[model samples]
Target: MPAFGLMPISYRAIGVAVLLAIVAGGAAALSWHIQDWRYGRQLADLAKTQAEALNQLTLAAANQQRAEQDKRLALEQRLQASDQTYSKALSDAQRDQGRLRDRLATADLRLSVLVDPSDADAGSGVSAASGAGGMVHGTVRARLEPAHAQRIIGITDAGDRGLIALQACQAYVRALAR
Candidate 1:
């Protein structure tokens, strides 16, 4: 070693050092870029998965709502049908009751005639009378105007009252049937 301004260095050693530095810097930059790209790709994949999951859940919710609406509509239709049936049944029952009332009224009119035909036909000249509670074995007495009886029957006949009495008996039986 002699006293010199600069230390003696070899050209090959300088070239090797320069080459090593360049290689090391390039490797470090490439590793950093690769890591950034990997992280960005991972974030993108995660966002895509979240969006797909959200879409599926929304579709499922819409399907459930549609099913519920269908069920509600079915229930409403059933209720309406039940109401119509009930109303018709009630109307039919009322009509039956009215028919029964009318039959009973007709029966009552016939019973009144059989019970006291004399009072019913008092203005018609023929007075057919009978006693109460003696309808089956009762006697009917017909008192007619002589002129009227002669005009209708050709004779003032009050003795042949058995036919009239048979009519009264038949009327009583008809009333009972009603």
Candidate 2:
């Protein structure tokens, strides 16, 4: 006699239940494996794309650096040429000034300035040779002292050098701008 009037369990039912469970587990495992393989392939492709982008960036940077270096070199060369040209001009001016000073020191050259008759003394400024309002009588021209003439030359020489230096600076700026 049964306690609750229930039917007895069978071996066949138990076997069928075990087989279904195994099939379900196998299907789930296969699905997980396929998903893992797809994810791995996607990751590999992403890494490749990143590597190619990095390579392109590196090449662009290198080319930009090279272009900048070349431009700097060209500017330096132009500046050097300008410097040489100004240097030569300054040297020539100095040489010519030296020759003129030598001539003045030797009495071969005389510096003179034009004078107005009204501004000059009538008796003293007019030489006895020919003072009747003539050029030879020192009415229109006055001879400068040697010391004063040398001082004037010195001043002019300094001015010339300053002008040359200013020109050189301007050329340097232009080269840099280019």
Candidate 3:
């Protein structure tokens, strides 16, 4: 109510306001610090979870690639084995053909074919030529000359080789299908 009383009361009110303001500012700063710590923990947990998922994915991809590589290696081994077997067969055929040709050249063997009796050159299923010395059956046997026999053998050799090559190709296709 008096001017002197107002001065003392106003001083006391100003001191209390300053103390309250300090306390409020401290409380606000503490709340912000707590929130920052909690949010930081959540962010770290999310990052850890993502890293683990990525690691698992990488392992799975590596395993799949390894399995594919193993399968390819097995296929290559099988193909190589098949190729070797086919190669052996082809060589065996060639050796046999060579022996047969040698025998023909030495006259140890002769080539013959059945001839029709109605033909002027045919016999009664037999040929009494000096070089021909084999019994004939019901069909007239006609002996081919060395040159003609050699040509026939060559044709047969070509046919045999072609068949073997075809069989090799078929086997290769079957292996791939599996």
Candidate 4:
């Protein structure tokens, strides 16, 4: 007897075993391919979402910048208008001040003539006649009566009140004459 306990191996069994191994490997490869495809799709979707978010953020930032610029421009325009108004006011004040100075000078001259008739320049055409005690223009009758002249002199003599008192005194004189 050759080998009583040993069983002989068959080629059919080996071929069947190899076929099963190939099928199992093919199944595993298909499963791995499907998993990779899903992972790639998920990554693409995440990228798309991130891109949309970035776009929205960019648009918001741009809008904010535009609003800031608009505000700055409006502020600048307001400042310019205020500056122009201030300049105009200053100009008007200066002009009024100049006119006031001129009036004050004329009033001072007239007052000087009235206070001292001897100091009156003949060419100035302002004179205080003897009995009138009031200023008389050359060849013209006295416009202020003696009482009005005295009252105006008293008002002016009281230490430098503003022009309002002088204006009031003149108005009073005019009303008395009327």
Off by over 4 Å in 3: 1-24, 117-137
| Predictions in order: lDDT | 0.60, 0.86, 0.83, 0.61
lDDT of 1 by residue, 1-178 (tens): 5466677788999999999999999999999999999999999999999999999999999999999998778666665665565555555555654554454445531222233545545565544455576655444455434334334332212222444445445544544454
Q: Count backbone clashes in candidate 4.
A: 0
Per-prediction TM-score to the true structure, in the order listed: 0.48, 0.72, 0.75, 0.51
User: Largest lDDT belongs to which candidate?
Assistant: 2
Give the Cα error of residue 1 in candidate 2, in Å: 20
Candidate with maximal TM-score: 3
Which candidate, 2 or 4, has the higher lDDT?
2
Cα RMSDs of all predictions? 19.1, 5.1, 4.2, 15.5
Q: Residue 122 in candidate 1 has what lDDT?
A: 59
Model 3's TM-score against the true structure? 0.75
A best-first ranking of the candidates according to their TM-score comes to 3, 2, 4, 1
Which TM-score value belongs to model 4? 0.51
Candidate 3 Cα deviation (angstroms), residue 45: 2.0
Question: Candidate 2: where are CA atoms >4 Å away?
Answer: 1-31, 124-139
lDDT of 2 by residue, 1-178 (tens): 5579977768898888888888889889989999999999999999999999999999999999999999988888888899899999999999989998999999999888877666666655643233564456544666889999999999999999999999999988888777
Worst 10 residues of 1 by lDDT: 151-160
Q: Quick one: RMSD of model 4? A: 15.5
Which candidate, 2 or 3, has the higher lDDT? 2
